[model samples]
Target: MAPLSDPAPRLARAAEAPALAALVERAYAPWVAVIGRRPAPMQDDYTARISAGQTWVVAVDGALAGAAVIEERPDCLWLDNVAVDPAHHGGGLGRALLRFVGREALRRGLPQVGLITNEKMARNIALYQRLGFEEVERREEHGFRRVEFRIAAAHLAG
Candidate 1:
């Protein structure tokens, strides 16, 4: 895995709403394909997330390979969405996105960060565990079984 800065895929603050929407849709297609649904709902939500300063993208050598969005509530930072192009899955971009979000959580004085993954997505749930998150709860939401996780407050950097 290359360090995020090794060759440095261009990273920037994406304030343009449409471009962010396009990135999110493309990055999410493969996963949505699994669910057999149009990505419209997610695309709308993600565009709003970006408009609200809750997201970012990383271009692998100038082409968008992944994106992550965070929503900070009073008590916890939420990883609302995290996606990597299926074609670029094992190149460390996904881990880099998670690590970046962790740093942001610590910086904003958030004691913890939380996320939910589809219950069927066992690999994703395992990945979150590997990144230091633990399952805190589970519930059915929007017709999808969901698993929720939270990082410990003490582990946050400050």
Candidate 2:
């Protein structure tokens, strides 16, 4: 475990689906028990996401260290998922990935970036808030209590 350098995020290729899935699963494993079920990202269609070019892979020294699934919406960029390998935690990879999403949203002319997380993920919620995301609402969906957060593009400009 060499300390991670700045992670370089690039579009994920179809061939890298398994690696992406593995990274996401490993990153979200601790939350499974808290959530009382497998998190949605663990069951995502990685092949489709990769083929759609909606998945980004962040590599540290050529090793997969994190990933984000971003979907372009008419009004905003939807950050469907973001995960950093537990081995690479505390290295700022998650924050870097989020900054990448904000940049992408601005680059695409979207007004904001939005995402949802399990309500039980208090640490994640706090992290998002620390990064300027505001909690907009909480609701039950797919048997999960989800907390939604949003960060307008204007906020990212500062």
Tell me, by lDDT, which candidate is best.
2
lDDT of 2 by residue, 1-158 (tens): 33343455899988889989999889999999998899999999999999999999877766688998999999899999999999888877777788778888999999899999999999999988987999999999998899999999657533
Query: What C-alpha lDDT values do all the predictions have?
Result: 0.69, 0.87
Colliding residue pairs in candidate 1:
none
So what's the TM-score on candidate 1? 0.78
Q: Model 1 over residues 1-158: C-alpha lDDT tens digits?
A: 35543223233354545555666676666657565664333546654565577767776555666777788889888888777766676777777677677777877888788988777667788888876889998998877778999985445221
Position 53, candidate 1: lDDT: 78
Q: Which regions of candidate 1 deviate over 4 angstroms?
A: 1-16, 36-41, 153-158
